[model samples]
Target: MNFHLKITWYPKKRKSTISRRMVTFSYQVKVNGCNILVCREAFFSVHGLQNNQGRLKNLQKYLREGRSTSPKDRRGKKGNPSRKISQEAVQTVHNFINNIPKYASHYSRSQKPNKVYFDHDMSISSLYQEHYLKYCEQKNAPQVKVSKCRDIFNQDFNIGFKLPRSDTYHVCDEFQIQIKNDQLTNSEDIIRRLKIERDLLHAKASAGQNMITQLSKLAKENPEEYLTISFDLQQTFPTPRLTSEPAFYKRKLWTYNFGIHDCVSKKGHVIVWSEDEAKCGSDEIGSCLIKFLEIQKSQANILHIISDNYRGQGQNWATVALERSLVRTGKFKAIEHWFPQVGHTRPPCGRDFGRIEKHVKNRNPTVYTTHDWVTVIKELCKNNPITVVKMKQADFIDLTPLEKNIAKKDKHDDGSQFRFSEATAFRFDEGMPSHLKVKYQYTEYEEFRTVNITKKGRAHQKNNPFQLSWKYLKPIPICDKKLKDVMSLMPYIPDVLKGYFNSLSESKEQSDENETDVIDIGYIV
Candidate 1:
């Protein structure tokens, strides 16, 4: 199978006539009698000759084996080793498992370690210690392993964990973490903080104040003259569970109705349904008010209905206007609507709705059907006692022993009696001028008359002065100065009465102008 070949080279040009002395070289060639091409020029050097012989040997071997010879094997025998878990990672996993009870559900029955199964031949003790024994109680039933727990916690509750996962347990833990880290000083940090700090501050501020101090200073100062009534709605949301279905699983249409109670009058009214589609329509608001007035008739005269600024709830300007219109039209009688200033409705008045919500939460009902839910709510409302205490000056007066001693040392002034005086008046006459000169005659006694009088020098012409009686007037015991000042700024009156008076004045002015226009047109014609 061995092949060897050789060749000699000679110059083509023989200028010296070397025909008789030819430079010829030859070598033994063995190729198994196979024809093969070999270059003669390649055998000039030992390196080239050796290379040619090696190539021939390789070709013969390739023919014998029927495949080409491969290049030298250059691949190394081993691969890169696996990365090892750090000590920090192991500690994190250990701590996570130790704190497992903190995150475990209150209803969870078992407190066992989690187990895991692997395809490879891992050490049984190591697998049991790391996962199986911790989660599984017996050999057959595999409890959720630490790795699986971590995955469940993360996937279900969006909590990140290292190891020893109990998904339910970790949810509360994650919430605690978020709450603890929420001390954001900047505006961006506020978005992360769940607990409101201002409410806590307010609670701390009002904790130890007396009853009188808590009431507005104005009411405390002049209790006899100004009557303070704190009005609120009750049972705003009567039934906590509208249906037997759980809150998270309930259908979208299931809604809860709130029962409104007034704290001052101990009256319970139901705001059963709100038209979610249409915002506070006039008819709905009027109906609610009319019902409230009808239910609580005895306290109707001195009543001041205070409520929040809910668009549909009867507290806005439109509601106020509608109440006045109804009164003027003689539909609603005796009741007056009074709205609290923008921020004054707090504590038991404006935020009474919040108390109702808390009570509803405390009385959680599992309602299976609509009728059952209604019956439950009706019973709850009927049994619930709403006690309204009439607040008086003495009731709020928290005169401590020290305060009593201090007051005893001071002299009490009883020179003046506190009384609210009428500050303004309105008169309407169709024939009266727009800017008529109003003159008041101060007499010892009050009287009303219509007089026709002649001017100082013009006896031929007569002018008629219409007199009006001021019934709501009280004698000013203090000073005419104080009286004048008080009168200048018209005292606060019921909105309904004010609207009625204004409407009367407008009608009178319109009629007077029409009369004057008619006289002018007749003269012109």
Candidate 2:
């Protein structure tokens, strides 16, 4: 005997109590000569199954299987998928991700299963579109969608797109975890101290920002008397920056941008240079500051500066010496430098840097050299054009020798030795040209721990105090490895920019000190 069966479905309009329009399906089944419209409750009652929408949906799915005879129900059946991702494809993804340049968190490198961060320019969609597709093509592996790639990254990898900031500070996190797990014997004391440290950091940061705001108002009120500014070094801009896939992998020459923003005038000065010209050291920063002060000398007699507590750039001996020299030269009667607590610095220079970053990101023209960056920065803001000081090899002066002549003592006059990194304020006054007044807390300005900056051996001359002279800096040569990388990217760059790439000459002897440092930039616009 031969049997015939058929199944059909159509939309059944239904409305819920919530007054929302909903559409469900009604199914009909025919076996041999009998035909019946499947009723939700009646079907379940007849089959001795639980009456529910899930069962009803499963029934509908089963009937719609398009079988010549009644099809078997697969709702409760579980088994491995018919096809799975190939091992080669998974390995390809892992290899591609592992090869992408990743950096360890500067502060949390010691954390277990170390959390690595990718560049801001990198994203799953971008990787899939710009690089992964071609990578798959080369390996003859099946290309995956962005969703698949994201899933693989989320489930298999231990990485983060953004690095953790002060909110999730590694030290605080470690202490909290230790206390919770009862891992430390003196956990209570440690917790209390940690809280105090965190509170002090926040308080100092708040005080510093308040001081800037006050200085801004004062500068506006008395433009000729007070000049308020914040300066910061932006992330190194890699040259030969192109949208092409090959350029993404190639290492390009570094271009440095030192941004100094005036609080009162709302003007930005970007000191730009290439790695071949000078390194982003303390001396280079001092040179930029000197140039900026020289330009603004006619505007103000006193200066107020705010910056992050970065030892290498702003809070170093060279910077202190440079400020002392400024006072000694009578360029400024008094200079007050404020440093926001580490990890809490949000300087005004960041705003200008953000605009520059946005302009570079949205620019239609390619930025292949430091000159291109200068051109972009010059016209960054139409209302007030940015002052782009394209720093030359001749402009930078070596302040290291002068800094050595300045005293770096262990104790102040009060017999209290403060950590250099812990100091939040530095004041240089013309009255005491050789003395540096230091404050550990930003909230206090009544008194300072005066540290005599005069070298012990050198006598402080009343008339001819510490004099600053220009010691010409030699040209800093690029490393051979970096030059080779730049050469590899030459083919991808435009012909007009080819000369810049060709001119990158490697040094005869590459010193480890000359190698570019991996700066962990945070919260900079």
Candidate 3:
């Protein structure tokens, strides 16, 4: 007699990266006239044979020494409650109800914000509220309100509740895992480069920590001469409540904030400007840093600045230019700039930003204009005297000339190479004012990279010729050209800000949209 056979592999044989070494296979064969199943494990289990006996020793070890997965043991519950729910009532409710609300621990709630977690078991009140008693309709069913149910659940049973902890995760794609097998053309060289980069990161992190230690010593020894500061940029929307849709879809602009925070004083200097005023670029950041230095230059003879290693803003040519310009002014005896290990920075400026955000989120006011945001922020930080300094387009300097001048007079680059990966910190000595050198690292002076400000060509963004004054507390009063249009948007604006839009400014009308030509942006009009 002839036989027909079929087989199926668990993961389908064609897929790459086998997750499991053993593939489960299911097969069936027809011999003669009867069909036969060839799953030995299933057959043995169905035939009343034990398969987990091989792991019995491990199970015994786990029961003896392994940590228990019980909430009572973790939360230090003393003893059983004075009151109790009958096991029969619990079993009866279990048949009809899907879920019963239980008690959650305070510690767990703090850890997982926005998540609901419960520690104690379901109360009699919850069951009553859930109509569990009605479903069971038994004579002995407990009668209780929500509050009494809480007491009953607390006092009654040893059955405790726990929130489900999501521990395991699955990646939908195999490519997500970097196996390093096929990519390893030469593992030795790749490992060497990895180690070099790791060392650089370690050195940078150590330098960032050492700055704190150095600040303590400097503050105690030279209190009047030493200053430590860090600065970063933040963006707040014109509106207090943000829509869930993509920002581009909302048809709105952003407000940029340049925050300079003193590490020792814990004070912040915030510069707020409209999107039309300026962008968060090297030029804007450089200007803000320069202004901050000008404010502190009179008091401190030595300045230490710590920032993150971002290309265009904090750790690039613009920053180098600012450092050189400051040192040349002779306001400080020594100036040092250090960048923390990328992705590991907890800058005080960032903390200042967080505080501002917390205040904004708590208030959640109606913000219809850029000035509205500035007003809220300034008012909130009024005690700290965080004034909203408006930056104009004219205030932004063209550093290209300075860059050229530095390289022209001194045969060396404008201390640009001081940013090399080997050095975590860079400094300019008061004695050797002309040159910039990486601190604590000795390298050939000639090997320093040159600073080229315009190395990366101009941005694609067109310059906004119209300079509207953002210093006002209200939304740039609907321009005359768009007065009717903005009035149409009034209905959509939040109720509190509706009054601001009722009276539009009678200012000069803007040119028709079709009159202005935009280079890259395509317009239907």
Q: Which lDDT values do the candidates have, in the order given?
A: 0.34, 0.72, 0.53
Candidate 3 per-residue lDDT, tens place, 1-525, comes to 545444334544646675544344454556687767766465335434476544433433443444343123323343665455556655554444334433222222234433433333444455465565566565556443446445544554434445322211122012112223357546767656655664564455445555655664665566687788877766555543344334223444456788887766667778776554455677667767666655655477888877766666576655665566566656678887776654433566777787888788888765666677777777775667565666665655555444443432222255333334445566765666556655433222334333232224443222121221222222232333335544555556778876645533322132234333211211111
Lowest summed-lDDT stretch of 10 residues in model 1? 419-428
Ranking by lDDT: 2, 3, 1
The true-versus-predicted C-alpha distance at residue 62 of model 3, in Å, is 39
Order of candidate numbers by TM-score, starting with the best? 2, 3, 1
Between prediction 1 and prediction 3, the one with superior lDDT is 3
lDDT of 1 by residue, 138-237 (tens): 3333344456545444453322222233123333345445554536435445634434543332232233112213333434455432222343333322
What range of 10 consecutive residues in model 2 has the weakest lDDT sum? 516-525
Q: Please, what is the TM-score per model?
A: 0.28, 0.63, 0.49
**How accurate locally is residue 458 in candidate 1, as Cα lDDT from 0 to 100?**
25
RMSD of 3: 24.2
Q: Which candidate ranks first by TM-score, i.e. highest?
A: 2
Q: How many angstroms is residue 141 displaced in model 3 relative to the true structure, after the best TM-score fit?
A: 32
